[model samples]
Each structure stands twice: as C-alpha cells, then as structure tokens.
Target: MRSVVGGVLSVVVVVAVVACSSPREPLPGLTASATVTTAQTPTPSPTIDYSDAELGIVFEDDQSLTGDEAEVYHWVATLETEYWRTLTTNTVSPKLSSIASPEIHVRMQQMADKNASIEGGHIGGVFRVQVRDVVVEGESARAVACLDYAGATFSDPNGSYTPEEAGFGGISRQELTLARVADKTWIVLTRTAAGEC
Candidate 1:
C-alpha cells in the first residue's frame, strides 16, 4: 500500500512541473514571434533669440537715449543674461570683458567660484534687470536699475532653493557706475545696492 501511494505522489509532482514549464498558445490572429518596440524620447526645443533692443531696459517717459547712453544701457541690461549663462556653463565669458571693469570681473569670478562650491551642484536660473535711469557725464556714466530676483532658482542634490529663500530675492534698486574704455565701449566700474525701488 505505501509503494502504491508513493507512485501516485510522484506522478502528481511530474504533472505540476510540466504544466508550469509548458508554453501557451498565442492569441487568435497573433504571432508568437512579434517584435516589441519602445517609445522614443522627444527632442528639446531651440532657445529663443532676443535682440539687444528688447532686453526690457525701460526708461521713464519713453525718453530717447543718446548713442553712448544707449550702448551703456544695452550692455548693462545684457549682463544679467550673461551671468546666468556663466552659471550654467561653468565658464567665464569673454563678453564680460566688454561689460565689466577689471575689479568687477574679479568679483564676478569669486562669485562663480562660490557657486561651484555649493552643496551638490548649481543649476541655472533667471536674472532680469530693468534700467530705470541712465546718466552719461563725459566719459563716466551712472545707471539706476531694479534687479528682479523673483524668478531666480538654485538647486542642490538634496533640494532646490529660490532667490527669496537664499536671501537674494525681491526688487532691489542697484546703482552702477561705468567708465568709457579706450575701445569706445563702456565698462561697469562699480555696482552697489541702493534702497528698494
């Protein structure tokens, strides 16, 4: 009797193994050798090109700017964009030479170094400047602008920080002093924060 039970159990185990290992028939109208494909990634859009005249450097009462004053305004307005690009590319831009003085360039380089040392890594952010007023006196020029930090964002490995959280946000008025260089270009000599706009 014990041998007979053992023989039955062996047959049951063999049947279960065969059932699990067997292949199933394909569905009607479907082939077993059909290929599968994955979705492709979408391409990124090209960056928009903004002309120098449309950099949002507004003057009071639509006042017409002189040739030198206009040049200074355009250069100062574009500095914010250049600074942002530097942060993303992790390389100092030669364009800075035309916009900033030697002392100001040194300060910008220091800031870039600090950005590189940020915990985790640094991501790009938006920086916009509006020229409220530009005063050109002989070879010297002074500009008052409002720097908007609302759209600025910084990210780390752990998380992200906004300009406000980083204590560098809101609308603050800045005064920039520029001097006409020998190349018939204006360079920012000093940039200081004035009171709120």
Candidate 2:
C-alpha cells in the first residue's frame, strides 16, 4: 500500500465515505487535540444543503517504512480519514471500534450528539497527514503524526469556521499510543495533542 504513484506524494485519495465520525463542538474531540468535550446544544441554523468535504488525503511515501512502522502509518491515516467523514456525514461512524480504543469511540459519539443541532455547509479541502515517528516495544506501539488542516473547515451553522475560529485551527501534531490486540491488529489506545509540528 506504500507504493508511490507518479511521485513521492502525489497519490491523493478522494475517499467517498458513506458513514463517518462525529462533529459537534469542534474537531478537538477526534482531531489532534484528542480531548473529549461535553456535548453542547448549539442554536440551530437553518440550512437546506448538508455540508460535505471532498477528501484529498495524501500520505508521504517513504520506501524506508516497513513492518510495524508502515502498519502504524496506515492505520492512523485510516482513523483520521474516517473521523473527518463525521464533518460531512454528521453522524458518528460505528466503524471506529475496529481501529480505535473504547474511550476514543465514545468520544466520537459525543461529537455526533453536538452535530445534531448545528447547521451544515460543504467544506472543501485536502487533509494532509504525515507520520513523524514510530516506536515499537513488544505488543505496544506509539506513533506521532502531523496533520495539515489548513485547507479544511469545520461544520458551522453560520457557514464557515475560520481556522482561528472556535471549532478548529490550521495544523496540529498528535501522538498516539497503540496496542496490539489478540487479532494482531493495532488499535489506537490514545491520541493526544503534541502541539504544532
């Protein structure tokens, strides 16, 4: 899956997510901030068209990446992509359990609860994800990733959420702890903010 197509990082995947993650207060819950927020009932904005974003997820192709490191990068990218779909679909995706911990799964559910009352707008952009480092020790693994959300906008009833606005920001760095379950698949144990990268 790490095969470079055409160039070092030109293989952009425009994933058409059918059902995805949660988005209510902001991306902090599922994003790099990684802190679960209490559900808030925001004033409902009247909008007919539901907002959706065209996902342009491009991962850095490094031939040196193999084994555990490659697996970590792949799963983390999948998790991010699925989480962003929450903004477009506005429903907490149930698929997270397969890739994330139980706590992270609940956090996403909280986000969807918030999305219930917000207005929608189609936010267009690409979410750039790059793995910074990976460490493996027995059945435990940790991966650090830098996400560029400069091109993305959160779901705002008022229309658009500026990068500096309430819901989210530009670029963020996250450190995730993963555990190898009985199935031999890596499940994300924790995802915490690691400041700007």
Candidate 3:
C-alpha cells in the first residue's frame, strides 16, 4: 500500500468501506432491520482447495488480559486483520467463516468481488487491538476496543483509490458484537464505529 493514508488507495478503498454492512435480521442488540436471505451467504468447505487462502495476518495476544476478554480481543483482531488481508489481496479467505458471521462475510466477499479486477495490492501496518471492556452473558458478548489502523496502507499500480476519496479514516475505536458458535470459537456477528480512541 503506497498511500498509507490516501497514498495507499487500496487500503483506503478497503478500509473506507470497512464498516459498511447492514444485516437483514437485527443481530441481538441492534434495533436496525437486517438484509434479505435471498442474499447467498457463501460458506467455506473443507473440500474446496485454496491456492491462496492464507494471507498470514498477525494478531498478538495481550498478556495483561485473560479469559473470555482476551479471546474476544483475539477474534476481533483476527477477523479485522483477515478482512484487511482479503481486501488488499482482493480474495476471500478460507478462514472467514470461522472468524466472521455470515453477515460480515457477505460484506467482505462483496468487496472482494469488486476487487477481483484490481491487481497487485497489499496490506501494511499492524492490526493492533486494545481491549477496553467485554460483557459476556450466556452465549452472546459485546466488546469495546481500539484498533490502530492509523498506519495501515494498501496500493495498486494505477493508484486507483485514495483515503480522501474513499472516506474511511482512523478506525481507532470499535464496538464488536459476537456470538458463540460450535466450541468456544467466537465470530464477529456485528460491529459499529464507536468514534475515535
């Protein structure tokens, strides 16, 4: 990503549209009406061989946090990092379903579809997540964290996009909603912009 800000147009293009998913059914706490099911939510199957599935986004665990709090942070970072990777590479990840709910996945896939024509872009900077707090009741959880996307970047040969043009800036704070799936695996059900850190 040459324009880490607007200079990194690919990252800006991807991150610019990062928080743009509106689900058909309201997820747990949200009062908004979600999207329609006619939307084909793609699922990753083990049988589908992936030649370029893993983008190798790194998310480190915070030693200061533990238990469900830390795990939630991990999932948030994982999903966000993977999403960024997906956008930069312009490919859907095999682990998407494992970390993101179908609602989130659909949005990511849509961007990937748009990115199919774009060539040679990459994700830069770190997906640093700081857990502020987490409230878990039963199988559902809500979390607040700061995601440092200030240094993030994505770029293509033509410089087709820019942060200013894309309109995504400072993903410094976030509110994440999660639900428990099979095992303790938590997926990002929904997330919204929570101002800045």
Task: Count the clashes in each prediction.
Answer: 0, 4, 11
lDDT of 3 by residue, 2-119 (tens): 4566767766677768667554565677665676678777763322111122443334334354567656656766677676677666788888988877887898889898777655
Residues 1-197 of candidate 1: C-alpha lDDT, one tens digit per residue = 99999999999999999989968786898886869898899865542232223323222223245577777776666565565566655656778877887876777788778877776766545555667588888899888877666766677788888877776767888888988886457778888888777
TM-scores for all candidates? Answer: 0.62, 0.64, 0.57
Maximum-lDDT candidate? 1
lDDT of 3: 0.65
Per-candidate RMSD, Å:
22.2, 30.6, 33.2
lDDT of 2: 0.67
| lDDT values, one for every candidate | 0.69, 0.67, 0.65
Ten contiguous residues with the weakest lDDT in model 2: 11-20
lDDT of 2 by residue, 1-197 (tens): 56665444552322223234354565554655457789899855532221224455655534255567666666776677767766446676767878998898888777766675565545446666766678888888888777777766554556666656744575788899998885447898898888887
- Which number leads on TM-score? 2
| Models sorted by lDDT, best on top | 1, 2, 3
Give the local distance difference test score of model 1.
Answer: 0.69
User: Residue 157 in model 1: shift from native, Å?
Assistant: 0.9
